[model samples]
Target: MTLRLQPVRLASGNDDSEAQLVFAGNALVAVLTHLAEHHDGEAGRWFMEAWFGPGYVLNRPTFASLDKAQDWILERLAEV
Candidate 1:
């Protein structure tokens, strides 16, 4: 499948403290699974919520590149 890359960020109290990189697509399930396997449960859960929400549904985003996503996150971080 031709996949599109979208970037998402998770913020807690402020934009800076809890930021992450989220890859969206059919491939995201695989990616999230791998991340869950490698990272702590809390971190994985937070990402899942930000990207997939409570029902594990995809959220629409504007950016389509990893770099763009990271950049946006960093910019938000700077604001906090």
Candidate 2:
């Protein structure tokens, strides 16, 4: 399966505005937000802000990078 990421800025009214829209084919799978300095240890990581479909829910995990987030999304998609 092929996944595409579109860079976007979320109007979260905070430092956590940088985000990406994750798409699987024509369907939107998830939204990933970049953690800010306020997150302390998690700062600079990518956080799963939202998700669609089954198997996509995983307690809104944070990834060290965009690649890892995409990998996790693919794994979840494969399970369904």
Candidate 3:
């Protein structure tokens, strides 16, 4: 099966609205990240999240911006 990272609409009742992550497939591979609210005013400190295999893992040293976060995620995805 091929892995895909497509934009998805956020469903209500979800905990992280600032960020959305969803995945489904037979191989069990996923990626997740968030623009945390806590870093709303912080500079050069953005909280990003990641989902590997069948679980979740947060990347260290958050990104500087949403663009950076997306770039980082894409880089990791390329490795998989």
Compared with the true structure, all predictions reach lDDT values of: 0.36, 0.92, 0.47
Worst 10 residues of 1 by lDDT: 29-38
Tens-place lDDT per residue, model 1, 1-80, is: 22344444333444223334344343342112112333444332333234432233355333433455445434543454
- Cα deviation at 23, candidate 1, in Å, is 13
RMSD of each candidate?
13.7, 1.2, 5.6
Number of clashing pairs per prediction, in order: 0, 0, 0
What TM-score, computed on C-alpha atoms, does each candidate reach? 0.28, 0.94, 0.39
lDDT of 1 at 63: 41
Model 2, 1-80: lDDT tens per residue?
98999999999999999999999998999999999999999999999999984654657899999999999899989988
**Candidate 3 per-residue lDDT over residues 1-80, each given as its tens digit:** 33445454444344344443423353323333444354456533444444554324544546666556556655655666
Worst 10 residues of 3 by lDDT: 22-31
Q: Model 3: residues >4 Å from true position, as ranges?
A: 1-17, 20-44, 53-59
Model 1 local distance difference test score: 0.36
Pairs of residues at least 3 apart in sequence or in different chains that clash in candidate 1: none
lDDT score, residue 41, model 3? 64
